[model samples]
Target: MVYFNERDLCYNSIYPHNNSWTMSRIELDACAECDLLLTPARPAVGDKARCPRCGYLLQRPRKQSVARTFALSLTGLILILPANLLPLVGIKVLGNTRDGTLWSGVLTLYREDMWAIAILVFLSSILVPLINIVLSVLVSGHLYFRRPNRYLPYWMRWLQHLEEWAMLEVYMLGIIVACVKLASMADLRFGFGLYAFIALLIVNALLASCLDPYLFWRRIEQLQHNHRHEN
Candidate 1:
């Protein structure tokens, strides 16, 4: 079962190679319930538990992923509002002071004709976190309510795919780089937002660790079967 979300609306894989080709395709399996397309994993014991199709776990939901994703998502959400509202970094040189927020950096990139970089920054730093929080809530609610949707499995799979692109740690690295360069030029002040962003980064990592696409997909199939009998 795949839950209804933007995450379920697509699929694309990028293979590793010197001249790798990108395979962009939306999975279209018939909906058993809730109009979702479920793509099952080839189950195998041991180290290769990941789905060959999309690299999701072939087994069930990992308990560790559940705990980590939930904890991180909750904490990240809490920190998110403040991370945007508070000043990220402040710089003072020659008695003149300047402050930078998340938007400031994006805008700077935009003005420089670095639209691609700006978009990447926007997606990773802003959009991806929001999607992760929203998807986690929906996926968790579906599991908790046990109200299986046909699309649930597909959503779970796609969510994991989306999760990979939401690299909060990478964003943090960029921030650290910027801070180092800024510090060499002037006296810099780190603010609450910086701490919040760091916390968010840890939260994102935890969420990824806790998520298991396989568990959700299996649950979805069972749900569809159960619903058929009821009808």
Candidate 2:
């Protein structure tokens, strides 16, 4: 049975129908963009549910979401250090060579008294992405193991909001622009870190694609409910 709270516009389920059942599970959820209350259908794998009014996507089922997200997030976590710490590119001009790493770039900006830009870059390019990946791992890992954690809901909420602030693609675009501008002026060489950064970017993209937020919220709710009953 689906019990919806009108006050918060959230649904609480009791004895939710199994996926194997012929009937689609009904759950109430509010559209994030329009705040319209909706009873989204449980989408089949490869299917999607959309808000009728705004056309905002409400749900999309991803097969093996927990395992896929966990693996990709772990890979991203492994790549983060090298991507930020190691030199991304090397430049040579008149027998002088200089290499640039993400961390070094932020430090350079700060040293030049562009602290505001430095902090912005650091948060958007590095810190936020790290947090996003870490939270993905934590939430997906617990869900994969069928372990319940009271903080899962909080982590998932943060993960959803943090997606916008993780600007790795923007940073990569800036790198490409700089490389094109410098190509005519000096010898340019790509570093291992560049490849690592690219891989991390791809993994993050895949992680986002594989995560099913609707499924995750339902699983977290079920897990927490079961835990409370057991206690």
Candidate 3:
């Protein structure tokens, strides 16, 4: 039997269904309610509900998510420097050794008449990571400092939207495939850059997940509130 006390938000009163009870609670705001669990249909004012977890509000981000995301993004940016500079993969076949950095990989593709693949590799491995990291850092820093950066939010939204295209892990997969195939023919020695690139992928994943657009907006709201109070 399903029943709820009057104090329970899920509970009901006047016309209780045969299988359930009713309760009443003040609905403060959608941002503070169980929005994620609510039916696709938007919640009406005065509606009683609670989030599946914590039962507080589904929209509110964990307080530290912003800081953590910023930190991870910064760390990823720092790693990117070494990942590109150091030799990512090395091949020593029959005592003949060859090493390549991220750019060299792109150049190799180009020299092999793999123009399309070269461009893709360049974009995914180099351009995309640079753009995503720089934008993430800028957006997070703006929010952290409580700066009035209208464009920062726009950039953050775009970064979040474009995350799937970054494909850092995909690049890593390509590297692994190349390494495996080359190792079969020659001795392969992974370099510091290869490990750094791998670490970068994990760090980038965490950075993206930790960033929450809603949380940044909340910061903006707080800044606005303070400005009004001052005025």
The TM-scores of all predictions, comma-separated, are 0.67, 0.87, 0.70
lDDT of 2 by residue, 1-231 (tens): 122233433233543557664433344567788887766666678787777667777788889998999999999999999998888999999999999999988999999999999999999999999999999999999999989998999999999999999999999999999999999999999999999999999998899899998889888988897999999
Off by over 4 Å in 3: 1-60, 221-231
User: Candidate 2: how large is its RMSD?
Assistant: 6.5
**Root-mean-square deviation of every model:** 11.8, 6.5, 9.2
- The residue-level lDDT of candidate 2 at 74 comes to 94
Q: Largest lDDT belongs to which candidate? A: 2
Q: Which candidate order results from sorting by lDDT in descending order?
A: 2, 3, 1
Task: Give me the displacement of residue 171 in model 3, in angstroms.
Answer: 1.7
How well does model 3 score by local distance difference test? Answer: 0.70
Task: Report the lDDT tens digits of candidate 3 across residue range 1-231.
Answer: 111112334423533657544321222223344343232222333243335444553332444776787889899989999999999888887788899899997899999999999998888879888888988888777677767654755786778677777888987887888877887798888899988998898998777556655556657566655766777
- What C-alpha lDDT values do all the predictions have? 0.66, 0.87, 0.70
Residues 111-143 of candidate 1: C-alpha lDDT, one tens digit per residue: 999999999888877887787787786666666
Backbone atom clashes (below 3 Å) for every candidate = 15, 0, 5
lDDT measured at residue 204 in model 2 versus the true structure, 0 to 100: 89
lDDT of 3 at 201: 86
The TM-score between candidate 3 and the true structure equals 0.70
